[model samples]
Target chain A: MNKRNKLLIRKTLISIVMVLIVIVSLFPIYWMLLTSVQPRHELMNYPPNFYTRHPTLEFWKFTFKESILEFFNSLVIAFFATIAAIICGATSGYAFARYKVGGDTLPFWILSLKFFPPVVAIVPYFLMMRTLRLIDTCTAVIITHMIITVPFAVWMIKGFIQEVPRELEEAAMIDGCSQLNVIRIITLPIIAPGLVVTALFCFIWSWNDFMFALILTRNKAMTIPVAIAGMREAHGLMWGEVSATAALGTIPIIIMAIILQKYLVRGLSLGSIK
Target chain B: MTVKKRALMLVLPTVVVLALIVIFPLVFSLSVSVRAYDIRIPEHPFIGFGNWISLLKNPDFYSAVLVTGTMILAELFFELLLGLCVALLLLQLPRSRKIFQPILLIPMMVMPVVVGYMGRLVFEVRSGPINYFLNMLGLESLCWHASPDLALITILILRIWRWTPFVMAVLLAGLLSLPMEPYQSAQVDGANIWQIFIHITIPMLKPIITLVVIMRSLEILQTFDIMYVLTMGGPGAKTMTLSLYAYITGFRYWDIGQASAAAWLIMIPLSIMVTLFVKMMEKGEKIEQAK
Candidate 1:
């Protein structure tokens, strides 16, 4: 074969591999959507219906109508937790970056806390929450979520803050601007994109969290994942209801990803690569 | 004194919060591991390694360790290999690089619990698409998650699916950031792609690769959401990872002592990995300075 033909062959092979990767990556989610609409009787059909033969909205309606309240509860908890985490993380991150109040070891120590497995302190957290009369409340869930989100925010924002040249803040200080005013007028505006990314990450993480919500919250503060897990009954797995719940849980995140694809992608890559 | 006192006041609130949320809980977990304090029991006694001793002897605990070990090794192996392959592929593409770059991160953004549920549905015995596709290809249907022997393999597959994008993203960044002089020189010397990779690319990428491996391994060791959502350590503990086992003992059984002991045991491996990572990073810094 000629050189051009060889290149063509290679391109074709690579395109095929890429297609396969996309299909493999996307098929499970596709199956989840397909199965959610599948009728109960047709769910277990052998040679499983690749496409829904008798598609219905019964499962979707059941999930929303029956468990809508729980879904709202999850949304409320995640929303508050994300806001609180962003506040704590951004302020502390700014403080660390600007003020040399503590040793460098302090920031590393804070970040290292992120590596502590939630399971390690989960039992104690549960007990502590109970003692504080915070069990089954949104406050409890939000506070527990801070353990994960604050570290993530601090780490990511610290990187962003360090990248912001120190001269701008120093110049503002020389102008006799208060620390709070410098943050509001100068620092926050400069790091706005970073803050947006950090907030979205915190939101997604809090929404995705399952273990803490499962252990700490019962009915009042249960998140989406816990609600989905509870969808299973003693009889058997309600395939349609479970699938519908999963789909509902996933749509918001998928939409957020598509909308803010740039920042979300950049943030994920930064956290992974750096 | 006043200035120092003001600085201390500013830092104190954050320190107290961290202590309450992080340090205090860690110490409490350690104490709980050595004490007999079941939530059901009001009065407790200090057991002093009784939980640790019991866990060491338990066959299920051993199984969990084995499964966790296998999962981490298998997932890391595939993630590194495929991640490198994809990174190389991305590097070769000149025009579509920007478009394809962001698309690669979709998997990492999908929630782990959602990934698990998606896998669970796809790997279902009768209705799952995997079995359906296999049957269409003139192969017998395989029990993906139902079979005890294949349980860990299923979890490993899910893990690789969810995390390979993470490895790809990091390696891609490293590959793109690298200077082209060495590779060009290797090409001028008539080195083949394979030779260039082994001699030039791998060495240059070692520090980043090491970082990815250690970070990914630490995260994988503590993985819970996917395992819990998919199999719940199912088919007779075949997929019982250390994190999941700890969750069961602490939360399900309410065996606080045993759970805390298991948690500390899990941390030992993680701490060792972390120390090694820090050392490797320091060595890499020194090498870079020397060069």
Candidate 2:
């Protein structure tokens, strides 16, 4: 075959595999959305409707009625945690990038802290919360959730901060701007995209947490994930409502993830890719 | 203030917060791990290595280790293999890359707890889509998580489904960022696609391969939500990873001492891997700066 023929074959092969890859990647998420809207009978019906022509909102209604509180709790906690993480992370990131705070090991120490299994911390965290009389409260969960997000935030924001040319900040400093003012005027704007990416990714991560909320909060501050998981109790499984709750917890993140797709690789890799 | 002092001041809040929430809690967890303390029990006493000794003797702890080891290896192998193929495929068509990349990441975005519930529904042997599709292809119904043999396999499938996009994202980024000089040289020298991939791509991508492996392994070692939701560490502890096992021991069984031991056991290997990853990253950065 000619080189042109071979290239054609390879491109066709790539097209075929990509089609399959896209389908497998999308089907489950599509199924979750489908099952959430399907009425009870259609949900359990044999040879399940691949597409629900007569979709019903009953399952979503039940899901909202049961889980609206947990959803809000997750919203409040994840949102606040992101804000806290970004503030601390950006400043710490600035220090690490600019001043090499503490020592050479300080930033790595912070990153390594993130890799420590939450299981290790769970026992003490729960005990600490109990000791401080903060167990089963949003404040308690937010404090711990920060543990998950802060290091990631710092690393990501550090990468973004490092990208800002030092000369710009120095120029600002020479013109009588203080260090804080230099950061506010010069660094923050340049790294604002990174900060947004870090915040969004941090929010999704804190929202997706199950172990922390599962261990720390029982009833009052139960997050959406735990509440969604609770639908699959021992005796019975509420598939429809489970699907609905999963959809509720996932859709917004999926949308934001799509919007931030370009930054996600950087965010997920903790800036190693850049 | 001098810049150094101001910098330290800038770092202070994060350092303090992490100390209180992260570092302090870990130390506190270690101390708790050495004691026979259960919230339910009135008399909590220091049991000095008793929990660790007892945990080492327990068969279930080994099972958790074995299960977690297999999970990390299998997840890494399959996700990397498939992710590489798709990533290479994506690299072929820059025009279509942006359009399809976001679609590919949908699975990665769905919450793990939700994936567990969704997996339970989709893999239901009686009426699930998987078995239904299999039956369409003339295979008999096979129980997934309910079968002791298939439970971990089921979990691995769900994990790969969710995480392959992540692996692909990293590797694809690695692939796209390659210098192109080697590939151009290889093509000019009449190298085939496989030849270039083996001789150039693999060697160039080795660092990233190790990176994704270590990172993903660290994550897989902490497996909990999916197992908790789907099997509850059953059909008979067949699918229990260390994280779930620790959670069960600490929270469910209320054996704080033993649970903390199990948690620490998981942490040792994890800590070693993390240290190695940081060192490699530092070396890579050093080499880049030298260049």
Candidate 3:
């Protein structure tokens, strides 16, 4: 066979494989969306309707009516958690990057916390929150979620801060700029993109959190995932309502994933690879 | 302030937060692990290593360990293999990757809890599209999560579907960042694609492969959200993972002391693994800097 033809054949095979990968990756999400809008009766079909003829907004309305408060609760918790993580984490990140604060072991000590299993911590946090009278409150969940987000913010933002040249910060210092002002003026602008990425990731983690939210909050501050889990009734899962909630919950996350795609490797890998 | 003092001030909040959130819970959990501390029970009696001994003896704990181990092995194997394949394919088609990569990542972005529910809907024995597709292909529909034999496999399928993209993205980034000098030299030596891949590519990608392993193993260890939403370690504990088992023991049964012991059992190896991986990661970074 000619080289050109061989190359063409190879490209064709690759394209076919890529197509299959994309389809498998996307089909579940498409199914979730399709299921969300389908009429209840239509979903029970033996050959399951791949395309819904009669789309309904009833589940969407029901999700909003039942879980809107929980959704708001999630927003509040994730927001405060993200903000707190960034404020605390950015300072430590800058210190670690610029000054090598805590030396080698201390930084890894912090990084290890990122990987600590949430299940282990949940038991104690539950007991602690109970004693503090913070159970079932957003405060408890927010504090609990800090376990995940703070370590993440520290490492991710530290990596970003490390990328900014020391000369720049040094130059600002020579100009008699105070350390705090130097950070606010010099480091912050340079690492602004990194800070945003770190904040977004922290937010997404808190937003998508289930186990902590599930364990910590009962009802008053139940996040969206907890609310979705509670959608079940005596007659098996209310699949449509569940799907509706899942679909809505996923949209913002999907958008964030796309937006963060550039920094995904660094963020998701906890800055290990980058 | 002196430079040292300023540095200390900067890191204080983080230290305080982590100390409160991470360290305190950990120490509290350790104390709880030693006691007969049930939330339902008022008087908590200290039972040194009692909970630990019983947990060690429990057949169910062994089963959870087995399930968690099998899952980590299976998911890591499949995800790494499939992820490498997809990354190589995307590398070949950089143009198409722009459009398809984000589309591919949609699964990873789907909340794990939702992924669990999606698993239920998609793997529904009779009405799930998977069965319908099977029927179309002239195969009998099989019960997925509902069947004990297939329950873990069902969860594996969903998790692999969600996480393979992350693995692929990381590997793809690694592949893109690879220096062209080696590939060019390999080409001059008349190495075949497979030879170049096996010898040149795999060795160069070792650090990245290690990174994926570390991250994915940690995640698979904590595989509770989906298991909770989908199986709840059910169909007779066929799919019980470590995290799920701990959750059930702690929350549902409210055997706080035993659960704390179980959590510590999981953490011992986990913390060891983390410490070791962090050391390896730093070593890898030093090598990169030297290069």
Candidate 4:
């Protein structure tokens, strides 16, 4: 074969493999969506339908009936938690980026806190929340979820802020703008996109949390993942309801994931990428 | 205010928040570990490592450690391999990276709880797609999460599926940002593709590979939601990771003292390792930047 043909064949093979990876990666989620709408009997058939022949709104209703509250709970909690995380994370990120807060050591120590396992702190957290009569409340869930997202937000925003050179802020400062005003007028606008990405990530982390919501909330403020756990109790595992709830829980993040694709490398690596 | 005070004002909220939520919990949980503090028990007394002693003797704890160890190792191996392959492939086809990158990230975005339940639904022995596809291919069906032998594998498969894209993303970023002079120089030296990849690509990607490995392993060590929803670390404790074991003990069994002990058991070593590892990462990044 000619050299050009060899390259063509190689390209085709790579495309084929890429197609396979895409399918494998995305099929489970598609399967989950399909299972959510599959008729009850259809779900348990000898082989579950690859495509639902007779899709139903039954499982959606059954799952969403109880899940709607939890869904909203998840949304509200994640929103508030992201706000808390951003407010704290952005300021600290700015401080670290601009002021070199505590020199390099302090920020790494704080960043290391991100790696601390949930298992270690959760038992005490549960007790603390209980003592404050905060169990099963949105406040408790939001606070606990904030623990996970804040480090992420700080690290992410720090990178974004660092990318905005000190010259811009210095120009403002030289114009007699106070440090605070320099931040408000120049830094905030510059890092706003980064903040949005960081906040979206915080929102997803809060929304996707099962461990915190499971331990922190009971009925009053049960989040969507907790609602899935609740399904496990009613029936052995309502595959349909579980699928429906899982699909519902992931829809927001899936949308956000697409939007944040460009930023995800930076976000997921906690700004290590940049 | 002086610049220092202004900086403090910017950073104080974060420090206070971390103190309350992060550091306080560390000290508090460690304290709980030393005491006989089960919610089931009426009296709370400082036993001074009695809980730790009992947990050391607990067979369930050992089993959990074994399962978690196996799972983490397996996931680290598979995700790195698969993620590296996909990353290399995407790098080869730069034009298609845009089309494929977002789709590949869908699994990473899917909720872990959703991953757990979705694992159950998609891998169910009798009616799951795996078995169905297997039977269609004229192969005998194998029980996935239901079988003890396969439970960890099922979890690993799902874990890798969720995270390989993460590995791929980070690696892709690393690949994309790789300094070009080395490759061009290597080419001028008449290095073959294999030789160039071995010397130049691998060396340049080392920091990212290390980061992905350490980060993913730490996560797999704490793998809980999947085992919880999919198997409850069950089929005779075949899949009980340390986190799940601690969770079950602390929450379900209400054995707070032992749970606290187990949590510390995971945490203490983990803290040392992670701190050191993160420091290495910082050092590595500095070296990379300097180069």
lDDT of every predicted structure (CA atoms): 0.79, 0.88, 0.88, 0.85
CA displacement after TM-score superposition, residue B65 of candidate 3 (Å):
0.8
Query: Per-residue alpha-carbon lDDT of model 3 for A1-274, expressed as tens digits?
Result: 6998988898888989888878878898899899889998887688788898899998899988887989899999999999999988888888888888878777878888888788998998888888889999999988888888998898888888888888998898999999779879998898999999999999999999999999888888889998877776333678888898888888998898889988877888888766
Model 1 residue B275 lDDT? 69
Candidate 1 regions with alpha-carbon error over 4 angstroms: A1-9, A39-41, A53-55, A172-179, A233-235, A259-274, B1-11, B275-291
True contacts kept of 4: 0.85
- Which regions of candidate 3 deviate over 4 angstroms? A175-178, A233-235, B287-291
Candidate 2: tens digits of C-alpha lDDT, residues A1-274: 6998998898788878888889987888888888888878787678877988889988899878988999999999999999999999988898898887876688888888778688888998888888889988999889888988998898778778777888998898899999778878788888888889999998999999999999888888999998887767732777778888889999999999987988888888877886
**Local accuracy of candidate 1 as per-residue lDDT tens digits, B1-291:** 664566556556666677778888888889899998878777779989999999999999999999888887898899999989987887776566666756666677677877887777888887577888888899887897778878778878888987887788788888987899998998899999899999999999987888888888888888898778778999999888999999999888988889999999998998788666555644543454387
Could you tell which candidate, 1 or 2, scores higher by lDDT?
A: 2
Docking outcome class, model 3: high
Show model 4 residue runs off by greater than 4 Å.
B40-42, B284-291
Assess the local accuracy of residue A212 in candidate 1 as a C-alpha lDDT between 0 and 100.
87
Chain A TM-score across all models, in listed order: 0.88, 0.94, 0.94, 0.94
Q: Candidates' TM-scores?
A: 0.92, 0.97, 0.97, 0.96
3 or 4, greater by lDDT: 3
DockQ of candidate 2 compared with the true complex: 0.81
Clashing pairs in 4: none
User: What is the interface root-mean-square deviation of candidate 4?
Assistant: 1.4
Candidate 1 lDDT (Cα, 0 to 1): 0.79
- Model 2 residue B223 CA deviation (Å) reads 1.0
DockQ for all models: 0.49, 0.81, 0.80, 0.77
Model 2 lDDT on a 0 to 1 scale = 0.88
